[model samples]
Target: MIELSEVMLEMKDIIKDFPGVRALDHVNLKAYKGEVLALVGENGAGKSTLMKVLSGVHPASTHEGEIYIKGERKKFANTKEAESAGVAIIHQELNLIPGMSVAENIFLDRQYTNGPSINWGKLYNETEKVLARLNIYDIEPTDLIKDLTVGKQQMIEIAKALSLNAEILVLDEPTSALTDSEVDELFRVINELKEQGVCMVFISHKMEEIEQIADRVAVLRDGKSIGDITKIEDITLDGIITRMVGDEVDEMFPKEKFERGEKTLEVRDLEVDHPLREGEKKVKGVSFEAYKGEILGIAGLMGSGRTELVSGIFGAYPDDTHGEVYIRGDKVEINSPEEAVEHGIGLIPEDRKEIGLLLTRNVVDNVSAASLSKFSTMGVMNEQEERKNTREYVDQLSIKTPSIDANVATLSGGNQQKVVIGKWLTTDPDILILDEPTRGIDVGAKVEIHRLMNKLVEQGVTVIMISSELPEVLGMSDRVLVMCEGEAVATLDRAEATKEKVMEYASGNF
Candidate 1:
């Protein structure tokens, strides 16, 4: 527990606003030395906006806020000024040059030099010291960033912050992409930092993670502080969630039962080679089937070949993939995404920004991108028809945006995800493959998406999902397939699939 006298960072009376939105309204936060303070909220609850205010991404003049470190007020004009003031934030998306070496990325833009030349030996040696301070021994200073795992890259991000001698650290969804074992390692390092009197502000949408690591919890709702920061032991998970969402969340999963219909999609002995590695197989001899009017869930840990299996089936990697896919009792070949789409298959990829979204485009363009043929005549698009169709979907999905003309990037994480789903739905596919559909989204959005899935299944559309969250799989799936090491090890019915059972299969424990 953190003592009251040891407050290391405090953000008081923060009020930030945009053109039509008051993102943060007089919000306050405090973090004490040697403790983890968790900031919990639904999407669009001003959590990211508040962090931007603190990190100088919004700037002091832009947001009305006062920040203090050790009881001394500080004004930061930019991120460099914030870093100079002993503040550092590791964003949700890692910001590192993948082609560079670890040492080079760690000391990016600020290199050790002798006159006009970089000091290679001194730079690597200094990087080694920073890594050693964090008890990281497996990664060498000269290793390429792309060669390392996601977890190792996260550690390097933390090391870079520590290299700047940052006293207050802010982590934004640090474990969102990590494996279970990797999350454990990250928690271990977090504990180590706590012992060294480094104050941390953790922002996450995960409830289990809050229970595991948070000493105190602060909830934000509709750009306002829900209440005072409360001790973790004094509140229930439901209580925190209620504070965040401003309502009783009686049913987070809301799974519905539907009659299973005929077999809609089937795959046999699917194999996909790793995109980069020469001889390594990502998905090896995997087979699965999805039935109409049912949601089939694929469960596994990260890197357990869950994403690769679905991608292979969706024809994301055509030349390197070999599989026999059958849709509606007839064997079909899917050599590309276009072929899969034409065969009534839709895939919502895991990485929404990289593979799913057009950040710079508007909602109408993004939604109609896959099905422009319906709104086009003589090779020219009908703009009014496109807008009307997009508006219909925007209302159907309850996507929050000022206008259909607003850039997709302006919406929150949840809304952006809905846009991706809307894009695929325009194609009117019979079989939907959703890879991490609810990943990194807030509780409200997750429930909404689940409800939409229920609606789809009731209409006889086949739904197949791949998720790392075990509880989601157990709650929503009629049948769950557990994968481990590029193989489908077990298939369990919803009645028999518990978290423990799924984890056992996912870890290859038999």
Candidate 2:
């Protein structure tokens, strides 16, 4: 463990407020040199708000706070001022031009010049140095950002921050989209930066990542710091959870068992072609079954075809999707999402902002989007019916919204996700498939969603879930289906599925 001797950054008595909510209330934080300080909280617990206060997204003039860099009080009016003060923040949604070259993106807005013209050689050479600081070499500076993997693009984001001579780095959910090996590489870079005495703040919802990389942990709840920053070695995971939510979490999973029942949905030799690459398949010859009164989990690594398999069955990916989907043991033809819905199959897609939500509309509109026909007759709409129905699901799901008429985008990540689930439940689907339903959500929200899943199963609605978190899959699944590189490799009952056994199959180890 590194000694926390030198305090590199500190925020004191920070109080930020909006028109109707107090985002941060007298919160304090400290980060030492050469160490990773983890800032964790439930969604809307002021983690992002606090970071914005520090990064000057909310100008110092707007918030009541005093920030100090190495005992020198500093106030930044803008992000550029924060950067000038040796501060940099990398948001989860990367801020890079995908069509440009790595060198171009890193040095964009201000290019290295020779006389009156841009010096190509000097700019590329400077980018190489920044990449080397992270010990990254295989990725050339001249490579197009679009050609790189998600993980590599994430590294480039860090490289851009370092290029600005940023001394205090803040990474927000940096590993949310990365593969396991990519996460390892990111940790390696972080360690290297720590050795160079660069202070770092890591914000994440993942407990395992915090345990692996953080030196100290601080919890936030309801816009207040729960307690003092405690050393990672001093606090148990249970203790952290308690501090985060202000209570003991008895069982995060809360999986309730159900007796084996009739089959509700089945897929035979499902195949889906790649959207762009010809003759390539995202999912190849995958088959699965979901039974009433049970949760069937699809577990796999990134690119293991779990999402594609469900999407193909749901008819969301219609082109070249050759699969025989059976509802209640009867074969059916599904050519589109509407057909799938008509067949009593509901899908909660993975991408929330892009596919699952209508951000510009209110919660009532989104909840009634798929089942508007139920609330209409003769091409006329029944908006009162829509509002009444929305209110019921909002209450049932415990979705924290100002009102049913409130814009869906105004809610927290967890609440927004609940709205999506509410939309599908209105249809009263016989079978439901959740693709990464708990992803990017807080532990509290995750627990709520899992409990809802159990409730659905008890109600006899078949639940099929796809999750990348192994612990979640192990905790909640009645049976686990392992996939590897477009193939369904193994199916194991909960009694026989261990982490080791599942990983072995997922990794194609037979």
Candidate 3:
């Protein structure tokens, strides 16, 4: 437990501004020697900006603030200076190189060298010691990062921070990509860190996790601190939520019943080979059907091949994927994304930045990208029609952006997701596939997306969604397909699909 009297880190009167808006306004926060201080806020509520200020991503000079470490006021010029001051931030995005060795990634840039050569013996020894200190012996220093699961990779990140002698650790949505067992393992590591007197600042949108892990909670709203930080014991989940949004959240999963129509899409003996590994299969012989006017949820742990199954149906890997797909009871050949789109199938890929959105382009460009043929004529472009369609979808989806010309990367995670969905909708797909639709967004945006799914199903669009979040799957899907090790193990209706049963199938126990 952390002592309330000893303050390890403090930020007072912090104010940050971007061109025409204030990103953070007079936000104050403190952390003790050993405690998890959760920073809770809605999307665009300045939580990320505040952490950036602390980590010197926005240098001390850039933001108006007074930072005190162990009662000494210090101004950081850059991220390096913050690290030297014992502050380390693990971003929401993983930063390790996939092909590199774990030890090399941990001691990145700072390695032991003799004359003109790196001492491989000392390097491996140091890495082993660090990993041992974290009570992790399963991973070796020579192991490549790609071989480790997402949860183990997260541990390596924490071990790297500890190697820097980081006294203040800032974790930004660390559990966003972790499984249930992995989250449990991470909490174990956190508890160990607490005993060692490491102060942690946790940022998450999941209220249940906040309740489980935080010693205290601070709420941010519209660029300002809502009130004094409250002890976890003193604050209710509803109370913290009200402070974050400044309103009561009546329902999070706003799902509605819709009449099921004919089978829109059906697959038989679907298989997808691993893109890089020659003989390995990412998705095995999986067979399922999506009915019009209904939402079909795909549930599995990470690496269970749920995403690959949908991607195969969408023709992501043509050379290695083979499946018999039927559209409205007629056999169809979709060997590529273009052919799939021609057959009235649309897919919102898992990674929005890498697979879905063109970050450098404007909203109109991204929204109209998949359906360019509809707006263009004989190789000539039609800008007016594209912009008109973009505006209509932006309004329909309630995408929070300044203008249709704004860059898609500038939008929030939820809005970026909406833009991707809107882009797919423009293709007029008979069957829509959404993978991890609400992975990193806040609760309000999650609810909005759920409502949008309800609306889509109501309009007779067959929706196939893949989610790691079990509550969302059970709440939104009429039928759930559970995958394990690249195979569809079981299919359950809404009434029959509980969290335990889903996990059972996902773990390959049933």
TM-score of every candidate relative to the true structure: 0.96, 0.98, 0.95
What's the lDDT of the predicted structure labeled candidate 2? 0.92
TM-score top scorer: 2
TM-score quality measure for candidate 1: 0.96
- Go through the candidates in order and give each one's C-alpha lDDT: 0.91, 0.92, 0.91
- Steric clash pairs (candidate 3): none
In the range 173-195, model 2's lDDT, one tens digit per residue, is 99999999999999999999999
Model 1, range 1-510, lDDT digits (tens) per residue? 556559889999899989878999999999898899999888899988888888889889898879998889988899899999888999888998999999999999889999999999999999999998889999998999999999999999999999999989999999998988899999999998998889999999889999999899999999999889999999999899889877898888889999999999888999999889999999889988889989999998788898888888888888989878999889998888888899999999999999899999999999998888889999999999999989999999999999999999989999999999999999999999999999999888888999999999998889999888888899899999999999999999999999989999999999
Estimate the overall C-alpha local distance difference test score of candidate 3: 0.91
C-alpha RMSD by candidate, in order: 1.8, 1.0, 1.9
lDDT for 159 (candidate 1):
98
Superior candidate under TM-score, 2 versus 3: 2
Q: List, residue by residue over 30-112, the lDDT tens digit for candidate 3.
A: 88988999998878999999988888889877889799998999898898899999999988889999999999999999888
Off by over 4 Å in 3: 1-3, 97-100, 114-117, 276-280
